[model samples]
Target: MSVLSAAKKVFYLPIMIGEWDMATIVETVAAMRVLVAEARQAGKSIGFVPTMGALHAGHLALMQQAKKNCDIVVVSIFVNPTQFGPNEDFTAYPRTWAEDLAVCRSAGVDAVFHPPARELYPDGWGTWVEVTGVTDKLCGRSRPTHFRGVATVVTKLFNIVQPDQAFFGQKDAQQVIVLRKMVRDLNMVPEIVMVPIVRDEDGLAKSSRNAYLSSEQRQAALVLSQGLAKAREMAAAGEQEPAAIREAVLSHIQSAPQANVDYVELYSFPDLAEIAVLNQDVLLAVAVRFGATRLIDNIILTPSRT
Candidate 1:
């Protein structure tokens, strides 16, 4: 073969190759676009899951759902700073890159867009995307700027990856509600998919911040899930009063000596508006603080039928 033919065989030929065994990790938006564009040109449907770097079973579960739904899955891991409050653990957020990639590989993620903070928010960056009403409840009340940061980064990720569908875990039910509303209101193209929360054997929802908890704190953290469970039971047992449901959840979390209850709210699903009764589908959410680590859990309640 001629030198030109050999170069073509080695370089250009590889570009047209059909598959990626694991995920291709790219650190810049430009690189992600090029990779995704090639996949789009090949007529493959893309699915995306945006995350922070500390990979857990929940993150893998999202990717698994993406794999089942779309032809390609892109997982972006950026520890977005805007989402964290001034006192929150932005610096302390875990960044286990090596283990994260391994999990992506096992879960069949197509590409991993792990951009640096500087690249995502360049010098003199000022724009943000915010969703109102829904933002006023749950985790939003305490972390005022949290959803704004989440909205902005997710919008940027959707614009960059432009997936056919994007996946998020139901563990952050408020986040799911906010993003769905944002996509619908803005008329975004990609479908927002909500996967079920993955919990530990002990029933605590999986989270990166769970790593921050000491043994006692971890034990205390179970109350968040347990409280939501009790609220679920109340709704299932023909209880429709919002006040009663909230009280039941509060009582469960209060039983934990180390647990500090933040909020136990029952609100309308998509709109997140207040409800006097639970006649319709509602979200039961709880946030509790154990030492310095804060955790949140939720369950969606559908009215019981005779």
Candidate 2:
């Protein structure tokens, strides 16, 4: 066996030795493949969590959930360029490789698949995957090609990682739904798991982009969460129209001077379709700009029996 393969064997031995305490951290695709092979040899099930580095508590929550369900947990930390538009902050996106490694290590991630962009998508990469309808609302309306980029990269990741199950935070509710649809439509085999959104004590959804916020912008950004809260309150207290729920959310954000509304949408939860009445599972998704930083948040409301 090669030294890389040998190292993987040693790293994964604890898993087969009936010790679930061991976690492996790898930074390249080759290392991840070797680790996955070793885990498979050990008859261990695999779970995957993919992210664009700058790991936060929200990411840790996804990793923890994966740890609970799969014997081998793999996390990928590649800032996929295809997912970012030309005008977007791809250049400024946070990337703390060493810090992210430390975070993954502490989270008990079995292997970290940190592949370079070229390896994942070669120079001749012309093919792209697009999911219609779901990408037509909220951030999609603004980003246009954004969901296509997301779908293409995610499909590539799914092909490369081949995890038996994948974990995504519900904080990106539309993303979760888009991926689920992609897997189903394409007949991909991995089971997709959605974890609840992790938030700060003040209710702002934890995100890597939160670092871009200035002290004042950080405070202004809380309007996204507060707006969602207001929508939930209005919906629960006998507001049944979808427009009413959306208006409530918009009104709250409009109250904040720094919050520039990008979109405040009321759509069918997970389907991304517009809803006339607020019945069953519906998503209240919003995107707003505080200074130059764009942030998103959503709340899924089920109709109240009352």
Candidate 3:
């Protein structure tokens, strides 16, 4: 083979020849884009999962979903500074780089776009992306600027990686809602897909923040899932009032001595508008503080048959 042919072979071998053991890790936007361009040139469909990098089974699930749908899967592991509030755990957020890569490799992820915060933001960066209306409830009421940072960074990732479809867990239900709206409003090219939330055998939704929980807090954290499950039971038993469902969840969670409720809200899905009744699919979301650790979980409530 000629030299050019050999170079091309080396570049495309991972996807073209089905080498599946490792994921190519690129730390800068330029390097990541070069990989994306190579994949596009190879006539491959790309799937992306943007993550904060504490690789749980939840992250693995996203990768598996992507691999099933796209020829090339890229995962970004940036702990975005813009998304964290002043009192938030941004500095203390887990960054298990080697473990994260191993998990991705084990799941057959093709590329990992692990860019530093500086590369994405740069000096004197002033732009931000905000989705109105849907941004005022649930986790939004407390986190304030959280969704704006989420929107901005995710928009940047979508542009940089340019995948055919991007996957997100419904654990961050509102974030998914905000991003889907941004895609529709801005005419973004990639399809936004929401994967069902992944939970533990004990029912606590898997999260990077779970690492902060002490043994007691970890056990106490089960209250979040337990409360959500009770809400499902209520809905299944013909309880359709949003206030009643929210109250049921609140009372159940408050019974746990260590569980401090942030908010237990039921909102109309996708648009996130307040609803007096569950006329359609609605999101039942909860956020709680256990010691210094904060965890959020949600379930999508189906419409009442009664």
Candidate 4:
């Protein structure tokens, strides 16, 4: 009901709390449930941040936001395989458990749940949670089954953590949209809190996939943010046609030698509906592949008319 002040030093570093041996890092759903129950019984509000391993600045920002609002902040570091396509980088995705835990500690997280895939999705796992409709566009078009996996695992995590608030970064805009819809449709209780994307000093959006980029590709990746900025400038200068705005972004990305763009388009905010005119606040989103790594970025366009 109310935000609680964080402890002077909150961490989960494989230490005992007392004779109880209260380990903050857990690997099993049963252990996680115990921690959640203990926190709730202690009258502490829980904040959940679901993420794959290889925590980054964006993730730290999410944890920081959570710390401000909840007395106990928990982060999950499971790389869900169902979210990745057949040829995608499921095997290659970074999984730095020690480094991730360190980051979580630095962010003052109260607990970390690093569940193995087998424990979460044992054999004969069939049921899934999917939020249809607006999912057919944006990142959904390229990786069709992505959101299905996202929704299912998130639903599971929500049930396990039962957090008072869940923290998420806006870099994954469509993901936030899908998960929020899933919560509403299923009548779940955890509040979805969307934080702004934390970017690098060079304007590139912070992402774990950035580790895959070569120096050249890293430099070229700037097209994503640069293009969005140019498009936003055009919208501010009375460019109301969605087609023109999309084209401006597309051209900028295509001109980069190391860049292979997937999509550059505008959609109605929150609903993700396709729009013909920029008559309302819209999301200017782009997905570009630099070498083998795919990166996504977006900016909300709220044009002011005189």
Candidate 5:
């Protein structure tokens, strides 16, 4: 077997292997392709965890989960420009390649796929992948082309990495739903796993963007999770009306001094269509601004007759 294949088998053994940084080897598509081919030949079923760099505990959690399920884990750190609008924070988005590599290395990630923009999108690239209906709600309504960019970049990553399974955080509930739908509709063969939202001790959902928040804004940001928790509590206490559950969440966030709601929505899970009642599985999602940072959080409410 080739050296690359042997490395994958050793790195991805069922035992918890120490994190290894493969970002240094990910300078080009040609190199990644060869590495992937070798890993596949070694009987390593690939698992992918894609991120926009600035890795955090939440991202690490997802990577660790992927490591458990697949023989090889590939993590991609590219902040796709196509997903960020002109007025958005793309220019200001965090990039800590060195630190991010450390986090991935600690998570036992076998490979870190860090592709540059020009290489992924080439000059004069015009093709875009858009998902209808779902992108028109919550964060999508405010950020417009956001989900399209996510779908496109994710599709491209899936094609390039060709993993047997992929992992995403539940923090971006809408994103998780959109990707799952895209994979199904397009007949992509990877198993999409939606891991639970990872949060701070104070309940703030961990995100790379959270780095942008000032000390005060950081405290104010907890409202998003507070809203989600309120919704969960109300639902468990016998609230079944979607509007009531949504309002319970919204009111908490709106009460915060720094919170400005972009959108606070309740939608059906996986499908993400609007639901008038909370009698089925649903996601209570919100996107709000604290200072200049836009953060999102959600809670999944399974239906109950109580």
Candidate 6:
């Protein structure tokens, strides 16, 4: 099937063609499916970016990357409760619907799936999708139930939208790994596209939860990135031992008065196996808590042999 060009204009009559400001926003699964079906019938390639509300530059960059590849782009803004732990910030998570829609519109998103939790979960929801191995480390060790919730909601969204491709940011490195494993193991069809993490001028990863940071807490959050950079530098300088690299990261994070180090781990890429030597490409991940707020950052690095 020939794919429609990203620049090609389509008309539905009464509505103007080739307009980003006219992006459609739908809240129901039924409506979202109808729109996806119509796009497919038109020979348009669909790109999906699923996210919780409170749009940020990172989310917008993902949408922009989607628009560059697919003729029709769909973004979901559901703040999934299942992904949060009992004492976690499910109730406190930011949800800026109007601003999110504006960001989507500006990015030329064809549809916005802003479904309510009741509509998606309803009652008696029992089944969930989980990928093993990859989820057993990194963020999973700390937030045990997190990836289960993520996989379930992502599977539901994929089923509901059935897009040609899905976009995800690399900031959530383990998440991308788990979702990729889920797609392969479950035989799902949507092409998984991993976009690089967009960061602030000071190198802090852009996250919705960053809003919770006080001025001091915000400064303290930099320790996550700092620790990751230090570990990467050590790997480049021929530091092959995992224990030494981890210690470097922990010490830097612990130096910050407001920061509490969560975990500093090194693992082989994709496989996520713990590594002792810096002989190949690996993932360096760190998490730090700034008072009540928790922040995470990671970098994929290739060890520099001396």
Candidate 2 global lDDT = 0.82
Q: Write down the RMSD of all candidates, one decimal each.
A: 4.6, 4.1, 3.7, 4.3, 3.9, 3.9
**Across residues 152-194, which tens digit of lDDT does each residue of candidate 4 receive?**
9999999988999998989999998888898888899999999
TM-score of 2: 0.91
Structure candidate 6, residue pairs in collision: none
Steric clash pairs (candidate 5): 19-105
Off by over 4 Å in 1: 1-23
Residues 39-61, candidate 6: write the lDDT tens digits. 78888888999999899999999
Q: Please list the C-alpha lDDT of all candidates, in the order they appear.
A: 0.84, 0.82, 0.85, 0.86, 0.82, 0.84
Tell me each candidate's TM-score: 0.92, 0.91, 0.92, 0.92, 0.92, 0.91
Residue range with the least summed lDDT across 10 consecutive positions in model 3: 1-10
lDDT of 5: 0.82
Tens-digit lDDT track for model 1 on 1-306? 321232233222121223433325676777777776677767889999999979999999999999999987888889999999898899888989778877887897767777778988999999999999789878999989999999999999999999899999999999998999999999999898999999999999999989989998898888887877877788888898999988878988889999888888888886788899889999888888998888988899987774
* Model 3 CA lDDT for position 188: 94
Give residue 123's lDDT in candidate 3 (0 to 100).
95
The numbered model that scores best in lDDT is: 4
Error of 1 at 248 (Å): 1.2
Return the TM-score for candidate 6, rounded to 2 decimals. Answer: 0.91
| Residue-pair clashes per candidate | 0, 0, 0, 0, 1, 0
Candidate 2 lDDT by residue in tens digits, 76-121: 8889888888789999999897778777777877677777777787
> Residue 181 error for model 5, in Å?
1.0
**Cα misplacement distance, residue 304 of candidate 4 (Å):** 1.4
| lDDT agreement of model 6 with the native | 0.84
| Over 4 Å off, model 5 | 2-24
lDDT of 1: 0.84
